[model samples]
Target chain A: MRILEYIALMAVPAVVLFAGVVMLFGGKNYFESFIKGAKEGFATAVGLLPTLVALLAAISMLRASGAIEFISSVLKEPLSALGIPSEIIPLLLTRPFSGSASSALFSDLIGNIGPDSFASLCAAVIMGSSDTVVYIISIYFSSVNIKKTRYAFPLAFVVMLFCIFFSCFICRIWFK
Target chain B: MLGKIFGIICIVSVFFGIACGNTGQLGSAVIDGASSAVTLTLALLGMMCLWSGILNVLKEAGAIKKLTVLMTPILKFFFPDAYKSGVGSEEIAANVAANLLGVGNAATPLALSAMKKLQLQNPTPEIASRDMITLAVLNTSSVSLIPSTVITLLRSSGSENPFDIIIPIWITSFTCAAMALILCRALGSATRVRTIRSKDYKSLKTQARQ
Candidate 1:
């Protein structure tokens, strides 16, 4: 953990320094290149705005309507039977769909249970290891204007489930 | 598939909430969701531009090329089709590099760029190719060496050992990424086989007619 923390703290600075030194010796016009890329980024963000609005609204609706909570409650028993802590089920359900919602659920979990508990640890690990699959898939695909995401959706969902279960399992052993 | 799911979820949520007499919350949720999306995008926009600028500088300096060279062996295993095609490999490498470096903001822009490049090589423009799916799955599985956000949240919440879960996260992230890659490869190959068989069947029928 000490070494990991050190690496995390230093990674950004190290990479930036390395890039700067390389650019200096490489004789590239750094500012021009940066501006060009920044323009591309601006386009990407603007292009994604519509999709973000739609996706986030739907996810929030699911949450606001109590659907996510309802779904999590129904799955709580079976998930707990499979060794998932019932307390973490809400985060698990929400994490794959929306980042903000999951983070909210995560803090709620940590706040309710305290940070050092097994469930909170699991939540942290889960949140760290996985991502908002639907969001990533939609944004990435839509950014490229690819409407037919054939198998990406199903494959991503499958992996999301795997990550959730695996994160809990690893946390159980590692934190224990 | 995703659009359908989103539509269904939205419709069901609206109806369910109204039926359950939570119409006020549902209305607010829709407004909040859209508003938050705007806020999130605004926040992400600057970071995306900043990181994109830096990454482009790195690319111009050939730093990313060197990193891609170093990553080839591992990337080859994960992105076989992209490597073989010799297209979008650079963006893929850059995207993966950003992801490994734990720069989420940079990763998204790089990933979107990579997806665009991959689309160039896509035979079917409307449909995603296998490599595109692989990239998305890879991102979804999240191979971040340091999950800085989670750590920040944990630290802010006053955890005694905030970094304690790093090892577990590293393990789980790697496992999930590997599993996702393998699953995509397996599924991709299965679909390929079916497509090939269909092509053969069509060719056979044409030969018979001739």
Candidate 2:
């Protein structure tokens, strides 16, 4: 199983390289296009700089302001009643805003509480399954100048709720 | 300006708390956390730029286009309305494929391009059509196969197996996608019923006019 996993991991880069080669042959201007694309990609990366800073700063503020603690306290009773650990609440709440920040929190949980713990595993799973809905809305929609996202928020929230419930249930049933 | 304001506020807040000596350790922790956050933000921005560059190269090489074609049928089922225009299907498929691969940083441009094509087909942009809403719904709940960024974090955090949660994650993702689809369809049916009722009233009015 480990060998297969390694092979799968290796396959992605191989496929990408193969695709690149295929493109090189598909057109006379393949090299030019590739260079142009790379430039555009780099430009996009530079453009995302401010949003990334803002996200990190906001995360910092939230943590510094004791907002996370306050939130955890408020959610403690309800989440614990649902069989989730208090530790997982921060990940569940923050994962949809800043993926890196949530991951940092996840790392802290794993380091402090141990990765083998059910809470860590559940947090990891929830982070993977859920999309960063708020980030997506702020970035994608705003970039496209989309003023009204009629169904977007509702759909994202519903899916997130379902994933959280289902993930918690599965973790309890299988890992427990 | 906002960043500077936030930085100042954070510093001031820390000093105020420290001067009061209300909670020395907490004040220190807050300052330390904020400074670390600035560093991490800088690092994340750098990483995003690198990934965006790679994605752009891949896209220009036509890998994205080919991948979109390969995924079109599946994408069609997910976003049926995207194909209303001639080549809109390919653009939507490409955008979605990029998004699912956790390449949303790269997918942003493709999505914008597709949205432009879609807008051209629409007569009125004031109200979203059923198809447009469906596209938005699917995009919002787009299933992820590999949680790349999460796995990276787990690996850095010393997980024995960063990808250990893959199976559970996939299961949860599919469940969410399934539910999103069902809800969209139910909502769509109600809209259809309303449309039919309105169409009937319009026909009756036409008959009265005649």
Candidate 3:
């Protein structure tokens, strides 16, 4: 199973590269177009620099200050009353805002709890299933300089909660 | 909006760290986090440049047009405003294709391009159109044929079967997207059922300029 996963990982880039070569043969101004696109990409990365700094700094501060841990513990009791495990709360909260942070936390959870455990599996599901909502909204909306996001922010968050609920609920049923 | 939220969170965290007697740790974390953000941005730059370059080859060859044709109907339904803008749908098609592959980095450039195109048609230049909101919804709750990142993490953790979560993630992705779409349709002013025609959009574009 792991072998197949590794193969798929290796294959995506290969396929893309192959397609890229095909395009070079079939297209006009290949190198010029690539440079043009690369220039655009470079600009985008530079443009997102400020937004990334702010979001990551805030996240790091919260993580370091123990606020996330504090909040998770506080939410645990109330969540348990509703049949949700407190162990997965941090992962749920972190999953939507930053991918690297969530990935770190997820690997940590699997290490502490054991991989075969239901909690670990649930963590995997939630992490895989949701995008970093706040990051996406902040970067994309700000990139186009659209100050009025209208329903985008609230709608993304609402969808995020639903992903968490369904990830845990379905994990419970499937792993049980 | 996010700036304000991040501000409140950071200030609260600063006070909380002081209260928790971890002022030194918090200070270091902030610096470390800021540096890592730069590192991540650098990493993004590499991937973005590579994919954008490669995809540009395909794009210049007009290969994306085939995908655009295939995706036109579905994209047209979800992004009516984008379709009205004509060229915006091309970007939308590329964005959606990258998204379904679970390559968020690859998708970001396309998504941003699509957003800019959609913004051009927006009645209010500063506000997102219906299509913009839907694109965000789609990107956030995107379906993936292979969630390579998640699987890699689980592998590092020594999961007996990391791939086991595939079906569950698929189910979760579908539901998240479905619910997001329904919510956007129900709660968004975008869904007031006001179909903004291209003629009206053009006139509004002029008005917006004025």
Candidate 4:
């Protein structure tokens, strides 16, 4: 099983390299395209600066203001009553909009709690199945100048709730 | 500013609630939690800026375009409306790719760009067309495969098997994606029918002229 997992991991890179090689053989212009692609990728990285700053600042404020903890406590009972672990609340809450922040929180969780624990598993699943709703909706809709997105926010919240609940439910069945 | 105001109100409310409830520990917990959150959030912002900047560079260099080409077929199936306008398709693909890679920080700008392009193609700004809504749904319910940050957190927390959650993660993500897709389709069809009916009513007078 471990070997299979290793193979799976290796496969992604192997395929990427193979494609790169194939492109190289396709024509001399392949190099130009590759360079151009890389350059564009770099530009995309730069273009994300302001949003990152805002997200970071917001996250900081939320944390500093005790808003996250407050929300966490508010959510604790319902989540725990549902058989969801308390430790995962932070990761689950943050995962949707700020990937990096969520990852950091995930790391902190794993560090504070044992990784093989139920809390860790639940956090991982929640992160995988959900997205950052507010960030995506605000940025996407605002960019397009769409003033009304009646369905987007509600749908995002529903999806996140479903993901958390479903992941917890399934994990209980599979792991236990 | 609004967020700050809301935060303060929340804090004050919590403090009073704790005092009234005679939960002494609650106050301390809130303080500690808030301070830690602020610190962590600051760190996260720095990381986001750095990462986003790099992603921006990638976009400028055309890597995003290359990625769009790579993911074109899937995007076409998922976002047929976007494909009608070359720009929409490209931007949508880029945004989706960024999300998939666990780069929400990078995905925001791309999503914005895609929305802009999508808006141009869709003149009726009042209503979100079928394709637009579908894309919105998919974007909102992005399926994350690795949950890299979560795994790292688990490992840090002294978990013996951080990646053990992979199977469960995959199961949940696939399920959510399937369900979201179905719901979006159903809602889209219903909305389309309503829009058509409205159009028919508006053209009722013209039908007599014809």
Question: What DockQ would candidate 4 receive versus the native complex?
Answer: 0.25
lDDT score, candidate 1, position B69 = 77
Q: For candidate 2, what is the lDDT?
A: 0.61
- In candidate 3, which residue pairs clash? none
Please list the residue runs of candidate 3 whose C-alpha ends up more than 4 Å from where it truly belongs after superposition: A1-70, B1-70, B188-210
Candidate 2 vs candidate 4: which has greater lDDT?
2
DockQ of each candidate's interface versus the true one?
0.48, 0.35, 0.42, 0.25
Query: What's the TM-score of each model vs. the native?
Result: 0.68, 0.71, 0.66, 0.66
Residue-level error in angstroms, candidate 3, position B158: 1.3
Pairs that collide in candidate 1 are: none
Per-residue lDDT tens digits of candidate 4, residues A1-176? Answer: 57645653563345345446655565444545445544544454445444343444434334444545676788889888898877676567556656545655564555455567777677767776777777666766666666767566777678778888888898888778
DockQ of candidate 1 relative to the true structure:
0.48
lDDT (CA) per prediction: 0.76, 0.61, 0.71, 0.61
What CAPRI class is candidate 3?
acceptable
Q: How well is each residue in B26-130 modelled by candidate 3, as lDDT tens digits?
A: 878778767766765665566566665666666566555576577777667666666765857888888777666444556789889888887777766666677
Which candidate number would show the highest lDDT if scored against the true structure? 1
Ranking by lDDT: 1, 3, 2, 4
Clashes of 3: 0
Judging by DockQ against the true structure, name the best candidate. 1
Q: Which structure is stronger by TM-score: 2 or 3?
A: 2
Name the regions of candidate 1 deviating beyond 4 angstroms.
Answer: A1-74, A145-147, B1-66, B196-210
How far residue B116's Cα lies from its native spot in candidate 4, in Å, is 1.1
Q: How well is each residue in A1-176 modelled by candidate 3, as lDDT tens digits?
A: 46644654565467477656765576465778778877877787777777667666776787789776777788988886665667777667657776655654565567567877877887877877788888888888888888878778888988887777788898887777
TM-score for chain A in each prediction:
0.61, 0.61, 0.61, 0.64
